[model samples]
Target chain A: MFLALDVGGANIKASVFKADDAFALRSAKLHYPLWIRGVDGLPKAIEQAVALLGCDLKGASGVALTMTAELSDVFRDKKEGVDKVLRKAEEALGSFKVVTNDGSLLDPDEAVDRYMDVAAANWWCVGWLASLFERDCLVVDVGSTTTTITPVVEGKVAAKGLNDVEKMALGEIVYVGALRTPISSVASIVPVNGLWCRTSSEYFANVGDVNLVLGLLREEEYDVATPDGRGKSVEECHERLSRVVCGDRNMLRPLQTRLVARFVYEKVVEKVCEGVLQVLSRLASEGRYPEVGFAAGLGDFIALDAVERAGLRGVLLRDLLGRDNSIALTSASLALYLAYKTGVDVGRWISSLR
Target chain B: MFLALDVGGANIKASVFKADDAFALRSAKLHYPLWIRGVDGLPKAIEQAVALLGCDLKGASGVALTMTAELSDVFRDKKEGVDKVLRKAEEALGSFKVVTNDGSLLDPDEAVDRYMDVAAANWWCVGWLASLFERDCLVVDVGSTTTTITPVVEGKVAAKGLNDVEKMALGEIVYVGALRTPISSVASIVPVNGLWCRTSSEYFANVGDVNLVLGLLREEEYDVATPDGRGKSVEECHERLSRVVCGDRNMLRPLQTRLVARFVYEKVVEKVCEGVLQVLSRLASEGRYPEVGFAAGLGDFIALDAVERAGLRGVLLRDLLGRDNSIALTSASLALYLAYKTGVDVGRWISSLR
Candidate 1:
């Protein structure tokens, strides 16, 4: 079995899988907000995730790793963050091969030396996974903390930007996400009783509360902590969402809070659609128009909404790789790719699963 | 001697003063960041601030408390937050008189029962102080975490909104601040080399970096923790500012970073101006337009800029009461007001300082 890990700033996902004749894959995810936990919390978090996945550390043939956690501010810079995360992984589960933006796996030392390439390369892994099914496509994976939109052409990753800055410039990355994005970051003013009121940029509420209030996300699925440190109940979400406009349950009517939620939902969708349109225009300029759009991750519905709005035929990656598997797509895809590279007939295994 | 405390979500400010034959006041501020440290850290943080001010807590007759910390997310709701913060204050200092939005002081038990009134009443104390100086004027106090625009009309506080929600609706509050405001909340797209680029919504940079890069704030004045867990040097500020667009020192040139900083600075100033204008229009509609504007607190320069844009005569509160005193204006003003109320003949002392 190969253990694949996708360490992000707000979440850490692990997938234990084998790519032989009899295929087996088990994945687990843990919300370990690196910004809150800091780099010091990585080892224990990684170990806890491995235990949750019920994977034997000694039995794993190799470890495949990709991380976006280095982007967290706990470290002074990305290089230090990447080095520290790698050291933690080694301390917990031994040596690992880190996937870089160039779609190559390098040893821990080499990855640390070229930290920028390895920092947020989880997108490349998911894109490679999408390329396996479709030669020309766009992959929109909206996870808990960020969204990655990647393009694949002629059976290879053809993204315009490799680094985060360039990717953001080209609309290959939209920083807004499903869960932890502050509501004020999405909307400066929200309408209440026909009056547009400015929002409190005080981290009073986040998108997760919006989704829960709008019935887009279930209470159990609200994995991250609520903005007010309140419960994730629908009623609690209303109170939290009300605070986006600096109100609470006693001050705002139920309908007003719902209005705020719907407004934020539309705004988030609009932001993702804007990114999709930007990417599509870039592709059109390059003379490559992808018709097939793949939506994956915890926020596949959000990605699908954007894909449909962008005038592309939306395909839910969850349909092919169960809902839970798709949420852990980056790590699972990395493991699958590594197995395929190691002479496993993963094509048959993947086809059987689908 | 009375010890005054202005406990905010991101900062804890204390002022030690006397309401006797001769008036004396000494103020000190500490950036406790209540959200990060949580309510458990409050007592210690308050004690440290008292120690910093070189005051004898036991010798003080009473503690005058006004807080915006109840709006922090560490507690489930404002009531719990207010109760906990009050408990911490009592534990750190002693019996206290909590300031309420009605511009009155109440004992601790009564304050807890009427938590909503006591939650964020610091603005009222500051407005009362402004009223003491000018019968008809708008007071713009831009602190590290939030801004309050209060109108003192006919020698009394005439703010249209009491709670934060209502205040936000009436433009009495602008949530952006000088130090801790996330850059993403200020500007979604920043101009880089004449091209508008979408910025990453990550907390990779904040307005403190923008102010530092623009020379509006010195290293020592940055005060709050940096977004990247880096130093307060100008070069470090440049690097953090660049990351607003997901770039770093290696990716962006010095000129590009400076341009980004300038753009963010302008956006912040514009946001504050919007709030000021909103409040001004409301005052004009009421047939009680304030001709003069008093700019105070840590972001006095920002407030002054906004006052100018709104066509109001700007007066820096710092010039009236030295720079350090003005930065801790909410607490200092509260102490001054309490002293005046106790028959200190503070009017003479204030004129002497001027």
Candidate 2:
């Protein structure tokens, strides 16, 4: 069995996949404010995830890693962040292979030299895994703070952008997602009380509250803290959304706040659709159109809606990988790729460990 | 003999005005990062402004204060911020009257009780001053981080919104401003190499660099540091703007970067124009249309452009108040109002001090 880790700015996820059946044996996720607290808290976060997964590094054949944590403000730059993460990962797991955007794995030493390729490359691993299943498809992963749109063609990842900056320029990365994104970032002007009102730019509410009020987010998926430091009740969500228009629950009717939430939700859908069309148009100009869209992430409903709105066939990763595996698909994909590359046989590996 | 102080989030300004001329005898502006460093730096900043204006507070008849510094993140909330500012101002100048959004002055004790009115009411002072010149006109004051659009009708400040949140909801406040505003906040898509490229959401460059490149901001006006912690030279500005499109000076031609800067400038203009039209439409519905626009602040050129583009007559505060006084018009207005209210002939008051 191989253990894979996906370290993001806001979360840390781990998965252990057994090569015999190509299935995840265990998985765990933890939320940590890596940006605010810095990388000093990362070691404890990793330990918690490992304990939750009940995994021992001594029993695993090898470790695979992909990370987007370098984009956090904890480090001065991406290079420093990459170096710290690699150093900590080595200390925790002994040694590991890092998955790069180029679809290749590098040892810890080599990964430091090629930090740009390894930084924020988790989405590439997911897209690569999707390409193995269906060629000529678009992978749309909408997470809490961002959305990644990658196209796979002829059983290979066909993305021209390698880093977040390049992907943003190429329309492969949209800085909008289903949660954690401030509502004002979606649209400055929103309809409220029968007229157009400019949304307060304060962090009064985020897209998570919008989705929570709309019933698009399950209680389990509402894992992050509310922007207003309030409870996660529907009434609380309504109150927060009302504050977006500088109104309180008493000042605005529940229906009015719901209308505001619907407007924000539609704006997010429109933004994702715009990203999809941009990527699709770039591919179509080369006479290559995605046959379908593979949706993942906690905000998969947004991707599903965006795919339909963009006139593309939609496929949910949850349907293919099951709900539990879908939640950790990025790390699981890294594990599967590492297992194949290392030619590890989980049945015999477990027998040896026993 | 009256010294007026306008403490803002980014700068502290002071002016001495005489009642007979209604023109400032002396004025000074000092840049201070109040938000980041907090209220602990306010005393030194005020002292610097007072020295620059060559004023002796002990000799002055009284002091008048208007502030937007309470909106800064230095304090926990508006109340705390207001109390701190009031305390500092009282410590520096003994006692003073604060201008409020209600177009009235309050003592320090009363000001603390009505903190919301005192919290960012500098714009109200400007609008009240403008109403003295024209009964029906829109006052547009664009600062480093936010824009305030207030309308005056029938010689009264006829603003429907009171605080920043309410003003934001009423379209009387637009968060997009001339300087310090991130370029990505203006437009997500920009032209690069003759193709549409989404600007990086990273704080690579702000509107200051954009204006600097476009020649709208002079070297002296480029007082704040660039977001990248780089130099303020023209070449450096071009490099920062290039990063907004995920390109550097080496990757992008100077012409390409110039194109990006022009796009951002136009977007800022469009946002200010939208605010002006919204406020005008609201007034028109009530059978009151502003025939002229009063432009103030360091970003007066943007307001001038926005007003002309919106098909309204424009009046420059510099043309009316002269160049030196225009820069500190907010404080000068407060001094003028205090002199009129107290019937203090500052010309004789200064002579009596001698």
CA RMSD (A), model 2:
19.4
Best by TM-score: 1
Candidate 1: lDDT over CA atoms? 0.82
Whole-model Cα lDDT of every candidate shown, in order? 0.82, 0.79
- Local error of candidate 1 at residue A283 (angstroms): 1.0
Give every collision pair in model 2.
none
How close is chain B to the truth by TM-score, in each candidate?
0.97, 0.93
Which candidate tops lDDT?
A: 1
TM-score of chain A of 1: 0.97
- Residue by residue across A145-189, what tens digits does model 2's lDDT show? 889988898978888788999888777888998779999999898
Residue-wise C-alpha lDDT for candidate 1, range B1-354, written one tens digit per residue: 878999988889999887656677778899998878888888999999989889788888767999988888888899998899999899887787888898788999999999989888888878877877778988998888688888888988888798999988777899988989998998898655324679998999888888888788899999989887989999998888777778778777765665566557666766776676667655543445577889988889999977765557899998887787788888998887777777677677766865
Across B285-321, the per-residue lDDT of candidate 2 in tens digits comes to 4656677997877788888877765556898877777
In model 1, the number of clashes is 0
Give lDDT: candidate 2, residue B311: 51
